[model samples]
Target: MTLYGLKTCDTCRKALKSLDKVEFRDIRSDGIPPDVLKSAYAALGDELVNRRSTTWRGLSHDARAADPLTLLAEHPTLMKRPLITDGTRFFLGWGKDVQADLMR
Candidate 1:
């Protein structure tokens, strides 16, 4: 399993603590591969982007109007926290439903 998120994110920290044997990738430093971002967007659609985040709020109108992939590529923090993937599957955020799914 691999977890993609910011290292300083409290949610990501919580997820790392709760989950076992998962590789953590800090999106800010390590950066997300285009293929991985593409796959995430494919699986999660618009939900992958956290429009409610400060990162989103800080974006210029033109930047906000840009494609989701471009937004994420320019600012990875725009992605919702704790994007957990287990090869074939992808999950966005650490919400209750996602937590339940992870438990399984």
Candidate 2:
């Protein structure tokens, strides 16, 4: 299992604490692989971007309108927290459905 998120994010911390035997990758330092970002975009679409985040708020209008992959590649923090993947499936956020899936 692999988890992609900011090391400073509280939600990511919580997920790291809850999920067992998972590898944690901080996107800020390590950066997201293009292939993974592409797959995430395919699966989650615009939902993958955390538009409400300060990073997004700071973005220029043009940047905001850019493609999701471009946004994420430029500003990784724009991505929602704790993008968990089991090398097959992708799950975003720590919401009920995601929690249930992780708990399985």
Candidate 3:
């Protein structure tokens, strides 16, 4: 499994600590692959974008208004935490539903 997230994010840290056999990618350093981002956007839709993030809060209205996919590509940290995938299925966030799916 590959986990895409920020290394400094507490939630990401928590998720990383709990998972086994996972490859962690720090989006700040290594950007998400466009195909994976596209697939994640397809699977999670608007939920894939994190509007509550500090990066999101700092974005100008104009930037925020851009297409979500475009915005995400430009600012990878704007994506929600720990987007986990196995090159097929995607799981966003470390929520109960996602944990349930991945832990199984």
Over 24-101, each residue of candidate 2 has an lDDT whose tens digit, in order, gives: 999999989999999988988889999899998999998789888988999999999899999888999998899998
Q: Give the candidate order by descending lDDT.
A: 1, 2, 3
- Candidate with best TM-score: 2
lDDT of 1 by residue, 1-104 (tens): 99999999999999999999999999999888899999999999999999999999998898899999988998999999899999889998889998999988
TM-score of model 2 (CA atoms): 0.97
- lDDT assessment of candidate 2: 0.92
**How far off is residue 32 in model 3, in Å?**
0.9
TM-score of 1: 0.96
Better of 1 and 2 by lDDT: 1
State the weakest 10-residue window (summed lDDT) of model 3: 95-104
- Misplaced by over 4 Å in model 3 are none
TM-score of each: 0.96, 0.97, 0.94
Model 1 CA deviation exceeding 4 Å by range: none
Those runs of model 2 whose alpha carbons end farther than 4 Å from true positions after fitting are none
Model 3 agreement with the true structure over 1-104: per-residue lDDT tens digits: 99999889898898899899999999999998999999999998999999998899999999999999999999999998889998899988899988888887
The alpha-carbon root-mean-square deviation between model 3 and the true structure, to one decimal in Å, is 1.0
RMSD of each: 0.8, 0.7, 1.0
